[model samples]
Target: MDVSDILAAQAEKHKAIAVEKEIPLDVDAGFLAVTDPNPIEKESYDENVEEYLQSTARDGVQVLLSALFSLPTTSSPDGPLAQLPPPTTTLPRAKPLPKPKPPTKWEKFARAKGIQKTRKDKKEWDEEKQEWVNRWGWKGKNKEEETQWLSEVPANADVDYDPTKKARDERKARVAKNERQHLQNLARAQASGAERKQRKADIDRTLATTRVSTASMGKYDKKLDGEKKLREVKRKFEPTEVSADVEKKNNLALLAKIGNVPAKRSKHEGNDAAINVRKAVRFASKGEGGVALARRAEGKAARGKAGRRK
Candidate 1:
């Protein structure tokens, strides 16, 4: 064959082979198409809710009526209508219930923020000593024992010295004694307020000039020095009787608001149902009874038959 004719024949053979290997896809069944134009009507939620409520009410009423009528009452020969004993009534509570405990962990967290129960259960207050004393444990016995290791050991005091050195040492001792005496006088003497201020200023200036440093790296901080005893003493004491007086007034007001309130049966929202009882009873008459109700009704029918035979 010619080259063009051969190429056309090869192409036809490849097309037949491709047809044999072709895969049929079910794309419409697998996924939503990009252009779906069908509109859906929204369901009415109010109608659904009403239907649900109606169904629930109808079912409950059916159950209740079935329970009431199917329960066997003891028949007396004296009367056809047997009177059921009334349910016992409960007495009204004189006092309200105690408040429930806190529900949230936040309340517990707040109470535990910095406070813990006092750890003074085993300790007692010694009013005479103005201190708390540990009562449950034996105290340590502190006996006075003199340590005598250095009693027989003598220090070297007699070194041969020059008279000039002795005189210099005596003069130095006298100067120190005079300086201590002057400081003691300054402490003991009562000074005017202005003099005290001047002395404090002089001391500060001297300390600044000398560049004196303290052993500790601590600085004066008011925050570190919390609520001290000085502040507690400064606070004025108010009598707590005013709170009791206010509580009494509140009690009186509450009593006045609730004047002559007669006791009544507890009111419930379900009692305000407007459904037809006749329809519910009709539905219930068609419905099957529970095992207990069926047995009770059978027993009642059997009893009636025996009484009729007698």
Candidate 2:
């Protein structure tokens, strides 16, 4: 048997790998995804649903695989690796974009004046030290005036005036002023938008509560002519229009729970004697009560002796 015919048939079978349709399949090799936009063939789909679906799916996969193989590959230890380009498809964000932070007073002023922001270098060249030193950190160039041995004193300087102390104080004042401005900016940011409204509402509620918390509960207090009456919140309860059977079942369940609870014991129930010890004590003491029985017993002998002598 000649195998040339079998080889030719196999080549013909593999020749038509390219799928054709009115709308081309969208293939993203980077994302390894294929989208088929062609309308389904009604006759083929109606004749055999599973076969038609499988052929459609196979065509899409064939196209995707062909695209993948066309990409340039690099040699690797395991095999040749194809480097995928950036994905063309854009995906939606998982979460909403964050709100912009409120700007500070300085930022607003700078924007209004059309001033561009410029970053300062962290390190500056020191001519005396012949090296680059930090601008504002430990042993930085900014502290040179305070750390220097000699300083220029003003003509009106006081007797106790020290140049080093003055320079240090000025530096500290600048740091304090920067910190204060930072705090002010933070306060301004927090006091903006919905948060500010919430804070104001809380304050109003607190004030209303305080107004009613007085000697007479604000009942006898003088009220303004245009003042609105405060409406107290009412308690919520289950509706009376519920099904009778459901209500009956609920009532029975409640009764069952109440029945399961143990009853409260009497004060003398703790005593386990055959007779009622508390009642006997009360009778023996002539209704002076069980607690006073000991005191009565202590005075009984003295009373008996006094009666006999009489």
Candidate 3:
């Protein structure tokens, strides 16, 4: 082989080797390849980048940087800046409140004048109606107009007042008084009823006692009269046609039955002796020859007695 053929052939072999290795031979192409691979190279390059950032911050150099070098670059007309948007600001709005209603005419009058209109004492003026009125007098109302009719007389008129209302009140008071009196009367009647009941009870008790006493006294008197009658009957009648011995025995039994002698025994004996003498005189009179026959009998009796003595 000649020297030219050997050099050309060696150059062609080197070209083929570059093509097989996929390595560009152009300087600009190589620069692009190096720059393009920088992001892959920077996968562990944060340590060095942090040191560089700290140095740049100390030197007061503002710079724009991205973690991925392949990312698109940002433009700044002012200077190198941090990769961030500006802060948003907003102002607060104020809300309005509702207003209160105005005061009424009457309320305003009350507040300003310090006086209130009343039914008993009317006010001098009506602000809404705009009219004058009596301060302390009656004011009639027009029913059709629905407004007060002022008096023709002066503001203060003294009308003749009727005390009939006062009289009516007095009448009511009297009625109440009468009611009170009626209640009192009822109370007294109740008390009187109780008293009457008590009196009736007392009368019944007295009548019961009187009846018992009268009955007892009447029984005692009747018993005494019966005893007197039995004694009189025994004295007035005696057994007739009895012998002297039997009579004497009967008299002794009657005396024993009569119990004790009387306190005036002498007077009783005297009357008994007198009654016997009277009975003997009546027997002599009843005999045939009155007093003469009695004398002859006495003479004969004397002679017989003399002969017996001799």
Candidate 4:
């Protein structure tokens, strides 16, 4: 059945039981009396009646069950009640937060000056010392102020004030600064060495390339010189005299065909004989002793042939 139907049936049964017993069912008062160990009395009956009703309305079936199964209460002054174990449930493991780094000298100074303090209604500056003064008189104000306070011995101060902590902080800062400079110098030396090595490598590569190029050019120049020498030797040893004789004969044959000469002259005839023949031909053509010159030439030829036969 539906929950509401079940609840209604149960209420009806309770009402019927109450009626059958002929007892007034002060449900709220009964619930409250069962729940509360020490119930307060009301002045008016109506007010008490309203309180009991409210208690019953606030609880429901839970109140009825507790009332029905309640054990008899007995006071024992010697011992406490037995405690129930807490409920167990699965839970995630929480990661631990990182520990905060120790504050530096500057940070400590700022904190002492109350620069890191939370803002509040009362904030005042001491004009004479140019510092902030807290009304609460908290220890951290500034290094100078803290020092001043430390100088003045207080009767009830628990913690001892010493300048050793500040001295140690200064020493740490100096050491850190020196270490940083040393590392920077080491890095600079390494970088300079690397640059020098690269430059040397580049120069070597250029020199090697130039050497190879020069060698190749030299080989080409040697090949050209050899070819030029061969050409020169061939020209110097060529048959120049035979060629010149053949050229001269060709020129003479061309001149004879053009009728610029009377006949083929003796190969032994000198320049003076050729010049006299030219002058005799010029005198014969002009009809001056031309027949006499022809007769003299025939006589001289006959005498030369007779001498050669003898």
TM-scores, one per candidate: 0.15, 0.54, 0.13, 0.14
Task: Put down candidate 3 lDDT per residue, 176-294, tens digits, no spaces.
Answer: 98788767666655565667889888987675455447656434543433232221124555557768998889789999888546758856455644356645655775654357657
Clashing residue pairs for model 3:
none
Q: lDDT for model 3, on a 0 to 1 scale?
A: 0.51
Q: Per-residue CA lDDT of candidate 2, range 1-310, in tens?
A: 8999999989888876868778989999889999998988999999999999999999889999999999999999999999997888899999999988888999999999998999999999999999999999888888999998788889999999999998899999999999999999998888777977998999989978977999998898899898778768989988989899999999999989886434554343765569987778778889898668888777898899999999
Off by over 4 Å in 4: 1-162, 194-310
Candidate 4 lands at a TM-score of 0.14
Over 260-287, each residue of candidate 4 has an lDDT whose tens digit, in order, gives: 6344544444363436775667676565
Model 2 alpha-carbon miss at residue 196, Å: 2.6
Q: Model 1, 300: alpha-carbon shift in Å?
A: 99
For candidate 1, what is the TM-score? 0.15
Write one digit per residue (lDDT tens) for candidate 1, span 191-290.
4347888999898766544332333322332333442222123676666666987888878999878753433422222233597544565465554435
Q: How should the candidates be ordered by lDDT, best one leading?
A: 2, 4, 3, 1
Superposed on all Cα atoms, the candidates' RMSDs to the truth, in angstroms, are 43.7, 28.6, 55.3, 42.9
The per-model lDDT (C-alpha) reads 0.50, 0.88, 0.51, 0.56
- Could you tell me the lDDT of residue 219 within candidate 2? 93
Candidate 1 weakest ten by summed lDDT: 140-149
> To one decimal, what is the Cα RMSD in angstroms of model 4 from the true structure?
42.9
Q: What clash pairs does model 1 have?
A: none
